[model samples]
Target: MESHDRLCRRLALLAGTAVLAVDYRLAPEHPAPAAVDDVMRALEWVASRPKELGQLLPGTGLAGDSAGGLIAYLAACGLAGTPALPDVLFLAYPNADLSLSLQSVSEKGEGWGLSVQDLAFYIAQWVPDASLLGKFSPVEVARAQPLPVRTLLATAGHDPLRDEGKLLAEELARGGTDVEYRPHPDLVHGFLTLDAVSPAARHAGDSLLAAYGSLLSHTAMLRRDRNAPPDAPNGAT
Candidate 1:
């Protein structure tokens, strides 16, 4: 929780928006299902206090990195039918599939900081039974009614999770959800968070923040249009 709070404080300075970095439990020691359950609980917690969250920051959105990215997707799905949809979802090199069939895992070699073996180890610790992949995998989840909230999903060219991220974006778009997907060819997994060292990482982080700002502007415009009095002489008359 302290980590999330500290990161949110840092990101708030750049995004010009109040950021809420959720600290869901980790896997292996906790198992995949438990990790997902933790995220669901956090989602429910936030939804329950919408007024408080709104007062803290008018725009309430969710953002995550790596495994947390996966949780963000699940969190969105958890709120699928609820009235408390997050205004935005920002993902960085998200792992959206448990199938682990993404080509980059093998074809791209070790250029990405993450390796296929590392992923396999993580999966083994989280999901030992391959047969139950569907239950735990985000991609395997059936398309929910109303689709997901507006999403901004980003991937790294050298990351194994790249194809999965694109696949997720396509799936969401097919389901009639709003999506904006971008991939940075020169980067690798966990880039944005590694900005303290890598220039490419910093660039990717800046771009993601810019995308969020654009979404906020559009949201503001929509709010203004909706709240404009009908009797007024502007476009609504």
Candidate 2:
């Protein structure tokens, strides 16, 4: 919720890309089932209004960072085969594992912006039962659905959640999802929003822009082909 308004401003600057950021209820105040439920409702509401996005929707993709990334994944997964199925997913240093066992968690605790303890505290405040943890984490999805969506996964080499992001990307690919992984060797977590002091953070922002362009172009090409006249011959059949 802190960054959704910022994302909306950023999206306005982009030509063909449109982003609809959800403002889910925060933790402790509005924990677990309520939080996830709020996210689902937001997704449904946004999806119900395709015209609000102009052309950057339906086949358009999803993107998020940190906790927002977690929500984006769950939203995208929930939308699979539905009216809102995203054509691609862009994740930056996502909080894929609430378990917080990634090596970077311990190694880059102070520098990563988001620490294991912070994540634990958030979860403690939000999640109702320990058993529900597995359900909330996208890492436990085990098998990915062939939504035929491409993914852009970026992780900071020095971040505490690096391996989890990497693992998530690998699992997506293993499940037949197209994934593009970027690991910034010199950066830490929360670089996208705090790039003023981190050069790598600016680079990541640029990379995300590029990834959005790629996916948009790909979607456009597919649209063109699908809408082409029947008599207009395609080289393939």
Candidate 3:
């Protein structure tokens, strides 16, 4: 998460909340399910005692970008149908389809920062056993179930994952989840990590993260005082 420190810090500032950054295992080193397991454990730890993180917090949320977004989605699915499920979800440019069956992967994969070949390598490394791809895929895992919570799903216009991310949002919404799908036409993949360098990326990324942070702030606020004024707007950046 070193590369994304800027985003985390900015989100904390904008939303007026503490951000717990979990250092989950990386792929090609620890492999599939390790990262997911780490996130699940972290969530369970938080849910087991929410008061420690924030006093009188109204809710909790799970957020991720790019590959982490994929893990967040999968983790949310695993935590579904329980009290541990998050109150909100924030996914940014997540490659929802691990099978690489989405159309944009072939049409707009190359020339962008993340190519199809590169994606294929990472995907294979994450799940060495091809047969288990479906089990780990958000598209496959979340098709029938609800999105687990209210979702703020964003897609990059020039990214190969654009289609699949959009598909995931649409399917989750169709399955009866409140979804706020934001297609960032001006941004690229990993915009959240590019905030410190690129103005447009910062604008787009901060706004999204800020939106999630706003929820956190709102939750904490309401929990502190049920009559704590009306809710603020969503995008705070």
Candidate 4:
């Protein structure tokens, strides 16, 4: 929670945007839908009480790193066609695919801190029922029902989950969702949380903040243009 708060504070400052850090339930005990449910509820609350949430404008986006990223994506998927759908998604090294189909899971899984075995253990704890894996996995969700929001996906080149994030970005783009894929060539998994210790991680963090800010500003501009009277002059205030 401390690390998340620190990162959120940095993002809010860098992007000049309000950040709402959710403290969802953990896995192994809460498991599967518990965390997802909490995050979905949080999204709903953000949509319902925009004034309380710093008067968040339309096109408010969702963001997370690793497991939290998966939750954010899933929540966005579930909220599709609803008033609570997020305008954008920013994922950092997200575990989008749980099938372990990507080669990076084996090649860079070990020796980089997060091993394939560690991933398996976490998956087991989160989704003990193997059959339910596809239902909870974001990649599968994207395959079944393409994401309906713009996305900024950041993948760490040295991370075990790198390929899956890349694959998801490709799938989203192919499915017609606007996506900006950024790859950090020298970072590893969990780097977003290690910015305090690693210069490379800090640089990655800055890049993500910049992308997020730009996306928000662009989306807000589009919204304003669409809402303006059809006959209004270009660049009209």
Q: What is the lDDT, from 0 to 100, of the residue 21 in candidate 2?
A: 65
> Residue-wise lDDT of candidate 4 within 1-237, one digit each (tens)?
786888888889887778888899988889989998888888888878756656556568899899988999998888889888888789989998988879899889889989899899999999999999999888778877877799999999899999999988988988889999999878999887788899989988987887898888888889888887777577886
- Model 4 residue runs over 4 Å out of place are 229-237
Each model's RMSD to truth, in Å? 3.5, 3.6, 6.6, 2.8
The alpha-carbon lDDT assigned to residue 45 of candidate 1 equals 70
Over 1-237, each residue of candidate 1 has an lDDT whose tens digit, in order, gives 654454466567777776555565666677767766776676677767767665543445778878788877777777767655567778778887778887877766465578787887887778878888766666666344345578888888888888888888888888877889898888888777677798878877877877776786577567678877677656753
Across residues 30-55, which tens digit of lDDT does each residue of candidate 3 receive?
99899998998898888888566655
Candidate 1 scores a C-alpha RMSD against the true structure in Å of 3.5
Q: Report the backbone clash tally of model 2.
A: 1
Q: RMSD to the native, candidate 4?
A: 2.8
**Ranking 2 against 4 by lDDT, winner:** 4
Sorting all predicted structures by lDDT, with the top scorer first, yields 4, 3, 1, 2
Q: Report, for every candidate in turn, its global Cα lDDT versus the true structure.
A: 0.73, 0.72, 0.84, 0.87
lDDT at 184 for candidate 2? 83
Highest TM-score model number? 4
lDDT of 3: 0.84
Off by over 4 Å in 2: 1-8, 11-15, 33-35, 49-58, 142-147, 232-237
Q: Candidate 2 vs candidate 4: which has greater TM-score?
A: 4
**Prediction 3 TM-score vs. true:** 0.87
